[model samples]
Structures are given as C-alpha cells and as structure tokens.
Target: MTEVFENSASFASDLDSKDELQSFRREFSIPQKNGKSVLYFTGNSLGLQPVRARKLVEEELAKWAQYGVDGHFEGGRPWFTYHEHAKKGLSVLVGARESEVVAMNNLTSNLHLMMVSFFRPTKSRFKIIMEAGAFPSDQYAVESQLKFHGLDPEQALIEISPREGEFTLRNKDILQVIEEHGNETALVLMSGIQYYTGQKFNIKAITEMAHQKGAVAGFDLAHAIGNIKMNLHDDQVDFAVWCSYKYLNSGPGGVSGVFVHERHGDNPGLPRFAGWWGHDQDSRFLMQKGFKPMPGADGWQLSNVNILGTAAHLAALNIVLDAGWQKLLDKSRNLTAYLQYLLADLGKTFNDFKVITPEKPDERGCQLSLFFYRNGREVFDFLTENGVVADWREHPLNETSERAGVIRIAPVPLYNTYQDVFQFSRLLKLALEKEHERITE
Candidate 1:
C-alpha cells in the first residue's frame, strides 16, 4: 500500500480532511519553531499539553484558594476523591476493571512499590527477568529492588537479549528464557513496548509463561500505555505501571498509574510499603495506629495523590476516552505502517540508512528506531535545526560493543498527522544527502 503524502502543507490539508481526531490537535498547544509548527514525532518522549490542562489545574487552585482546609471535602469534586475522576477513563484505555486500576505515583516509584508487594524471592527461587535493553529508569529501579531485598542485582536479575545481528527481541526467544528461568525466577518484569526498539512484546503469552513457572508477571508500560490498547485484564498480568507523560498525552511530569489484577485485590496480606493514603477513609484521619490496607490497587498508594498532576492527566485522558482507544490504535497502526513505508522508501535512495524498528506493525509501536551508518549525530542535529523533533536511543553498552547509538523517530498518533511522517521522511533524506555532500568535500 503506497500512500502518497506529497508535502507537509498538502499533508496538513489531507490531515484536516479526514482526521476524526483533528479537533484533538487543537486541544493541545503545539510548540512553534522558526514560525512554523514543528513536525513533532516525539510524543514517545513528552506529550504536548492539552489546552484544557490549564483550566483543569486552575480548578484545583481555585478549590485550594477558596476552601483551604475544607478542600478535602467541601470543595466541588473534593480532593478526597480527586483520583477517582481519572480512574474510569484510564481503565477504559488499558482494559482493566475500575477497581483494579488507580492513579498514583510516578512510573519508576510505582514500579518500586509493585516490586515491594509482588517480587517475593526465596533463596532458591529468587531471580527476576527483564529485557537487556530496557529503559535505564527501569534498569535502575530493578537494581534497587534487588538490593532492597538483600540480593545482588547482577546475580539475581536475569537480562534477556536478541541474538547476534538482531535488532529486536523475538517472541519465542523471550518465552524460551522465561520457561528456562521460570523455576528460579521470583518475578518476570518487562516493558510492554521497548523504549529503544519500540517493539511491542507478546504480553499475553509472556504473562501466561511467567505464571506457568510459578512467577508473577508485571510490565513497565511507560512506552506502551497510550501508544497501543493494553488489555491488562485480558492479558492476565499480575500488575503493571505506566507514566502519563508519553503516549497518554499528559503534560511533562504528569502522575502515573498502576494496575493490580482483581485476583490480587483481596490479598490483604501482600507485603507493601504503605502510607496514610493507603489506609481506609473512615480511619484515615483518625490517626490509626496500624495500617489496615484498603482493597484493590488504591491500597498500594504511598502518598496523598497529586491533585494538580492528576488534573492535567484527566484533561489528556478525557480526550483519549472521547476518541475511543480502538480508533486511536487503528490510527497508530496505519500511521506507523505508513511511517515504516516512508522510511523504507527513503532507504531505497539513501544506502547508509537502516530502520532498526521491526518491519511488522504488530511487533512495534509508533516509533521507528533508525541507524545511520555515518554522521548520525550531525544528521540528528540537522533534523532538529530544520524543525523535526525526534530522539536518539543510546545502545546497551553490553550489546553495542563500542558502537554508537541510533536515532528514534516516534510519530505519535494523537497529535501527529500523515504530513508529519512525510515531512520527517523528506528531512531525513535531506539530512543524509547533506551529510554525504559534506563528507565528500
């Protein structure tokens, strides 16, 4: 399917013509570069803020300014249930029961909290498995969890990798590692979509495999949450954590969410690092001596929810809910497939380029990781100079063996249009051609 996007302006016209979510683009404040809106394909890094975010935040501020101490209850949409507003929408997005999901701490912190409860390792079966090239934050969080449990991360943590000359992890290989290590593994933790390679793992199969080995399964959905429809309940994942800043379209530093399967909701004895927020509301202000946990994921909370951040998250989630996840994911698949096509087409003209993201649309998300054989950094700098915004992925030192990293071009569906993808393809061509000319001289 060769879909033609002639130019950015024509792409915008085409975008305006058929974009069911075009109104949503207006909802966000698009950043300007050189008097033109940047062909932003970096929503995998930070989402553009919804214009309603300011209004939502101001509501909280108004409540605080008016009610002060009484804002906990007296204010309309009381602070007491502030997080409830975001739950149903987020549940819809991730396909989880309302009781199973909660808006809470940031992603890494939530991962640590989930690990505290779920990562129970005995001396004999104490290994934790994760992808070798997971986001650095996840790596550090897992390492901290290992140390917190009085175990060595280097020893207890099992990192999976692809074979030689491979760019993405094969599903069978990942399952094989899980099966091989399931006997000794305490928990199986992996990213829903790899941050660097943008590979969307086989979550359902992986979750079942982890359970078959008597291990709990979890996901760091920082890159997957809104990039794709995550059927957490259908997948039967034990627990999951994700940040709102990326594909969720929440502004920078937005609050995160956690999912605990309904099966684990009633497990009151599950060990956790609790705070007053996790206590029952009836006894919460009573200054109870003991920590009797609330039921479900809410019981995992470690602090009072961030009302302002949650408000920002709600504005974004509202748009997502209105658009419907099925439609968004469909756009994502088509948008990314078109992007891959454009990249492949560009590669036909530019010999030194290779797309590091998987060819199969189902195997990857919206981001395409690109490997430039020469002048990669200069090319990246040039793209930025010409109003294209993407990111660079630093390779795992162990995997790279002293090679440079690749540039990641993530064209998020919520805000990016076909024009954005086409323009990026054009700029990539220009960047490479300019680099070639420079090198020849």
Candidate 2:
C-alpha cells in the first residue's frame, strides 16, 4: 500500500516519534542558530560531524605522544595498519569483499590510478565516454589523462548529455552512446549519482553496457557512498572511489576509499603508479624493493596511511555500522519522499520552482535539487539567513549559454529527523510567500 503523506507539523512530529533510528540524531553535533538547532540539510555537501569524532582523533594523538615512532606497530590501533580499520565498514557499505576495498587516497587520485590500469587506450579504441557535466575535478582528471596519452580530448572524449528540455540523462541514451562508440571506447567513467541533479545512475546497467562494448567501467561514488546502498561486487564494477566527508559524516577532506573488483584486485601485473606502502607487507621493511604490491585494493596505497584522518572516518563509520546500512537507506527513501511530496503540493499554488532530481526512489537518494524559475537567488539567500544550511549552484541547463540556479537540500537520515524536514518545508513556504510579496509591492 502507498503511504499517504501530509504536510503538517503534527504529522511530521508523529513520523519522527515513530522513526526507529531517531536516536541516532543525538550522535551528531547539529549546528545552532538562535539557541536552537538550525534546519541543517546540506549532507550532500558536508555532513554534520559525529559527536565521537573528536575523541577518536585525540586518542590517536595520545597514542603518537606515548609511543613515538613505535606507534606505527605498538599502539592499540597501530598506525601501520590504521587503514585496515575501515575495510569492514567500507566493504559492507559498497558491497565488495573486504579484500577488494581499501581506505586510501582522495577521489580523483584514485580515479587516475584506476585509469592507469583500465584505460589502456589503443589506436582504434581510445575514446573515453562520460557524462557531460560531471564534477569539474573528474572532468579535469579525464582531460589530463587523455592529453598524457597524446590524444586530443576533442577527438578522444565522448561526453553524453541530457536530451532537449531534459535536466537528467536517460538510461537508454547512455546505453546508446556506449553501443555506438563500442568499437572506439576504451573506458566509461561516470558519477554513481550526479552531484547537481541528484540522479542516481544505474551502476549495474552501466557496467553491463560498458562490458558489452569491451570498455572498462568505473564510477566516482563521492556523492553516492553512504547515501545509497550499492552492490558493486555483484555488479562487477571494474573499480570505484569516494570521499567520506559528505554522507559518511567524516570531517572535511577525510581519507577516501577505493574498490577494485576481485578480478583486477588479484592481478598484480596491472600497470599503476607505485609507492612504498603499497609493497607487500612482509617485504616492506626489507627496503631492497622490486615493488611487489599487496593483493586486492590495498595494492593501490601510495603513502603511509594518514592516521588522524582515518580515525575520524572510523569514528563516523562506527555510527552507521551500528545503525545498519539497510536501515539508514530505508529512512533515507522516506525522508526524501516526504520532502518531495510536500514540495510538490506547495507547487500547486506557488509554482516558482521545479524539483529536478529523479522522481523514482530507486533513481535518486535523499537529496532534492530545486531549480528556481524566479526569485531564486533571493529565496536562497533568505533560506540561508533563516538558518537553512543548503547548497546553491548555477549549473548549465543544456549545451547553451543559459544557466539556472539550483538549491540542493539533502536530509541525511542519520542526523536529520522528520520534524527537521517539516520545519524546512515551513521555512520554504514562508520564504516563497515573502519573496512574492516583496516583488508585488
């Protein structure tokens, strides 16, 4: 049976009262305004910090102080294997074997490493296909990789874009591009969920299509990880990478992670930029190095793990693992749906904005990106002034000079309650009405 959603504070409070994971909200330190918790909704940008994160970092500091260099091997959570602490949680979240996942490197750096092994561009198959408006960092990485291979991006890059009048790309269109360029495509790298539109691409289907075209398939999960449940192992994704600061609630620039399918993880002969830490553990101290990599994703590490950063991540990871990944996803869908329903209802009488994120729960996550047709900047500023911590962007609409402002609101299930969503809708309605009055007067 379809659940009927109502736009009322009492209804929202009732939903919050019944939420099984409501207790988890106390685990985070929500930002304050006017001596009350702000309507925090930017989890897609930077997640609220976990209450335990500070102590986790301090513990690592104390360990370093006591053990000195010996901390590498002598501490409770030794720095030598600090990255290992994250594997269990990372594996469960991304749906890969622990051996196939590793906590290491930033998102784009890992992307370059994966490309080194997977994007072996040949004379006939040299084109790299991707979404046109991928995050700029990914775009720069792909462009540089092509140039490094002496291939001009104009000739070697295929960027699939949304169709006319559409804000998101169609799956059929994406598949069609892969098939059409099957002979020439060497790699297909895409965002698991679009950063701007909040559209969750079909990782399994995209991987299947890339394989059909004899091209390597990989994803940047910076926006998808911790926000959505993935089955990358069963889906046979070649590799993937993501940062932990957003949905994972780790601090800013926290250590990122990578997933290499068992197929590639087992292959040590794969070409990659090597480093000392990536060497086989048993022989790492021998220092007479031929550079034998640790098998699986651990083989990709380029430096001694950043103990402090990984500690903060593990602190946050503990909360999600306790909450259960599936349970968090369940609440995420409902929170996004309630917000969507309420916003759509408001649109009936006040039609100034459009929700551009995919309507299907399966095709999106907790985020809803609003494309304002009028009074966008004013309304967004008003929300910010009123303590709605949201994200604002002016993204390209199509292959034209025109662009539109987007306000992204992500209600993270771990720390956000239904009452928070209710309060946001209330603020949004007031912002809109106030803006309308100011313009008319």
Relative to the unseen true structure, what is the C-alpha lDDT of residue 298 in candidate 1, on a scale of 0 to 100? 87
lDDT (Cα atoms) of all candidates against the true structure? 0.85, 0.91
Relative to the true structure, candidate 2 has a C-alpha RMSD (angstroms) of 1.4
Candidate 2 regions off by >4 Å?
Answer: 398-403
Q: lDDT of candidate 1? A: 0.85
Q: What is the per-residue lDDT of model 2 for residues 38-122, given as tens digits with 9 covering 90 to 100?
A: 9999999899899999999999999889989999998678888889999999999999999999988788888888899899999
Instruction: Give per-model TM-scores.
Output: 0.95, 0.98
For this target, which candidate reaches the highest TM-score against the unseen true structure?
Answer: 2
lDDT of 1 by residue, 243-265 (tens): 99998877788899999998887
